[model samples]
Target: MNDITVFPTIDDIMAAHQRIQPFIHRTPILTSEAINQIAGCEIYFKCENFQKVGAFKARGAANAVMKLTEEQKVNGVATHSSGNHAAALARAASVAGIKSYIVMPSNAPEIKKKAVAGYGGEIIECEPTLIARETTLKEVVARTGAVFIPPYDYLDVIEGQATCALEMWEEGIPFDTVMAPVGGGGLLSGTALTSKYISPKTNVIAGEPEGADDASRSFKAKELIPMVGPKTIADGLLTSLGKINFEIIMEYVDDILTVSEAEIIEAMRLVYERMKIIIEPSCAVPLAALLKNKERFKGQKVGIILSGGNVDLGKLPF
Candidate 1:
């Protein structure tokens, strides 16, 4: 585990961006007049959906892999994720010419499993439970000497995620608010840190599903709260907030809003209809939250991170 006591600095984040430059994409910002009109706000979408590995997870995975020592690289990298992070880490390891071991739940979407395997990851299937996943990962690491790269808890991962917001800021848009969907809170916390450092006036907000509202609850309680029995269509946002991510979010994020599943699906359909983009349910949470609280953000220039596009198309709600 990384030293969670220390937070990443702007210099650290900048260095991470440089390190992962070759492995990731500088995903474009998109706008839809229709979307802006509906929300009554000028909205800019940071399309990480178009990113390498079809998500921003590539940024953090690449940075963490590149930061590994020669000895560590030889031993390779390992993690447990049933979603984009697993494939991202696998692809990063493949690019770096190192081995990767991904411990995925047996019940993970078949498309996701195939993606990890396609990226050259050796898959280790475990029972569909956190304890099972962690136990399996630990056994794999013990046997293979692979270094564990947590999805959202490590400083390097957070630094890499911060680059997404940094890119948005570099585009010269003076955004009044920046939003990201909170799952494990990697992207949200990183976004908050970058916004606070570069533009403290920019309010950082997070959107979470009503069904999986640990982040919203934790933000209000000002303490770590484990997610229990999350049941949302936003599968990517199901994980509880990490300790490191929670601390940064409490200090930097302005608010967390929860939205209904119907709102999430509606927002997703609107993006697909207006923007002609394919974003997963989790990616739509921020837009859903914004639409739900349109009055609060009226006429404001808002930047929303479209987290990923890696949805199981066959199982899509629309």
Candidate 2:
């Protein structure tokens, strides 16, 4: 079994990058003159929205699935996610020629459900609660004997996520700060580890939705706070921070900033209008935080990881 207690090292991240390179995209780094002018900073958006599953979850899911032992692969992988991770794992499992069982809430977006189904994953719907999701996942695993691959908490998953930041660093741009949206903290924690390792001077910050600000609260309190009654339009970010992810963030992250719902919607709209890019609300949290605190990042080069672009067109907040 893969050791969950062990933290992934820089070498592990490098190897993960190598192992999954063929399966994932080297998503582009985009910059906008209008956005730069508005924010009073040079911002590079690492466009993971163009990633294989239209999210950075592809990296983590692919890494974890590919690393499974042959014996483990036979029964395939299982996970509980509302959207991105479910689609990502399904796609990754398809690439590995294995089955993927996704336990999603019945309220999960239809687009996400379609994506998972398109990738040949079996969808099991449950009540729209954390406890329900976990309970259903446990039942599915028990019945199918599928190896459970958690959305964010697993070491291999985090190691996979580290490669996204690894790509940003390899681009040779010395960003003064690197930022990502914090939900389960897979992307944020992985980004923190890579930034600290590659450019220790570069501050690593995470942006979170005010409605679901467990990460910010946890960071300030120096303890993992479970998310309760999270209410945000950023549906993908409703999950609580993972234990492994929290530990890494506490060690390497500089700060956690929260942005309001209006700020998130405006930021998402700005990207769509100015940059002509479609980004979900969750992906805009980092930009929203930066825009809300422009004075702090004035004249600095900031790198923001655009987590995904899986928004429902029919239900746009704009």
Candidate 3:
């Protein structure tokens, strides 16, 4: 739609890097020689789990919020997110010294809800559905006239998400494939754009959980396959890709793969045990895909984006 909304090109992503550098953390790349030797692939991990708000969503949120016009800033901002985006927007709003209204699914994790409030944003609980989230956001926007900062539907946000890839490219290491978990496809779209331009030879892959492979379907069908709602172990990847992201992903992404709940759980345990890093199920999907498709990456350098570390131990099914 609308020529795929050419968002944050490599230049734009680099600018986002500069714009958010003062605010965001350049999360470390965690590596495990042990796993590498066993898996037969050199892996470089962009641990966005170490990022502020515990996810790369903060990068996009912060950039979009900061770009608001003075008038728009004065009116405030609003958004709908299940978790990471909510925390990110709330944090970004606080940094920008503006009021933020976050509408979240009623069933969203309590920890995520609390993060939104902790960042000084007002929260409104909606039905556990995107329709409700959008309805509430529209009402808030119409009433307060706040700028609506979309989660993954906006260009600025996409560019900011791509910055993670831009930063990863700094090592001058060429990857055979760059794999990122897909939810709303914000991260995948950004990663694909960055990889295509920065490392033209690299294949960009989008990882999704089985029973929730909307992006895969969309890519293969070459049309937007909107999932009203999806069920998946990776909560972060429960939504279908956005229209803009679908276009980019369909055209540029090499493949959209799926992993099972068992694979994700094992991946999570592996990361926690071997890498000594905590990651949510959503963040583990990419790694799970890599583990499952080892044959494809055996001799190539692969980059995986561990999207976030925001997991509640008590709620986990151990």
Candidate 4:
């Protein structure tokens, strides 16, 4: 079994909150009476979609960027991401007066690419394959001497991700279960760690797309599952979990669940129609899992981190 605890403790997570306080947004917690009725339970939705870069990635990227020294800052930073992380790094680096070098898939959403440019990030387009993205980022780092900021695989980033849980817990609401969609596992790993530390009795569950079910399989197999191409509509949750993230999640998390593409689409529509919130398919996985397995959470106070709200409304199939 792979056994390691790579996440920050409650004290450490709290400290990171203070460290990144000025740079990050404490996103809102939304409640809907109609939605709550449908679930047959109280639900708290942490709206990270309103965060900088239109996702919660801002917290980690901002924290990681600001922690660099003045000398290192001038050398700039590099990273490979689907969309949100690239935008977060670009915006955060702009705020810190540092250059951002982003390597992204050529097919990435234009709006996100435009946002990166708007924040003064230098974009290098690469093919969508994992190898191509890594190779392109490697060349950039070698050429520019810019440090690589991984999308979801650093201790600083994980600590930054934990702050959402800290902010949510401050509401004084006790939750029996907490769920967050796992992408590269930064956000969900942090959620699991925070829930374990602050509320030891609470269960932390990760909701992953069935097409990208590495986390779920790894958790059950008790080992790192090599990630393959992710085929799903939830573009934001396609990446594999990092080693550090997997370790922390394994130690602190209770379970990793999955949702189908159809379920994700249906849940996205439900969130929009009932809660009046626009969410991407990735963020809908948690809700989909809950509804798909309603008996487990029927009466429990559930806290779900809505990962993002960047879906193209015109693309909704329903």
The weakest ten consecutive residues by lDDT in model 4 span: 1-10
Pairs that clash in candidate 3: none
Residue runs of model 4 more than 4 Å from their true location after superposition:
1-6
Report clashes for each candidate as comma-separated counts. Answer: 0, 0, 0, 0
On the 0 to 100 scale, the lDDT of residue 260 in model 1 is: 95
Q: Write the per-residue lDDT of candidate 3 for residues 167-197, one digit (tens) a residue.
A: 8889788888998999889999989999999
- Write down the RMSD of all candidates, one decimal each: 1.6, 1.9, 1.5, 2.0
Query: Tens-digit lDDT track for model 2 on 275-304?
Result: 998888899999999999999999999999
| C-alpha lDDT (0 to 100) for residue 237 of candidate 3 | 89
Clashing pairs in 4: none
The alpha-carbon lDDT assigned to residue 65 of candidate 4 equals 90
Model with the higher lDDT, candidate 1 or 2:
1
Highest TM-score scorer: 1
Over 4 Å off in model 3, which ranges? 1-4
Clashes of 2: 0
Best by lDDT: 1
CA lDDT scores, all candidates in order:
0.94, 0.93, 0.87, 0.87
* TM per candidate: 0.97, 0.96, 0.96, 0.95
Question: How much is the lDDT of residue 219 in candidate 2?
Answer: 95
Per-residue alpha-carbon lDDT of candidate 1 for residues 1-318, written as tens digits (9 for 90 to 100): 565477888888888899999899999999999999999999999999999999999999999999999999998999999989999999999999999999999999888899999989999999998899999999999999999999999888988899999999999999999999999999998999899999999999999999999999999999999999999999899888999999999999999999999999999999999999999899999999999999999999999999999877788787
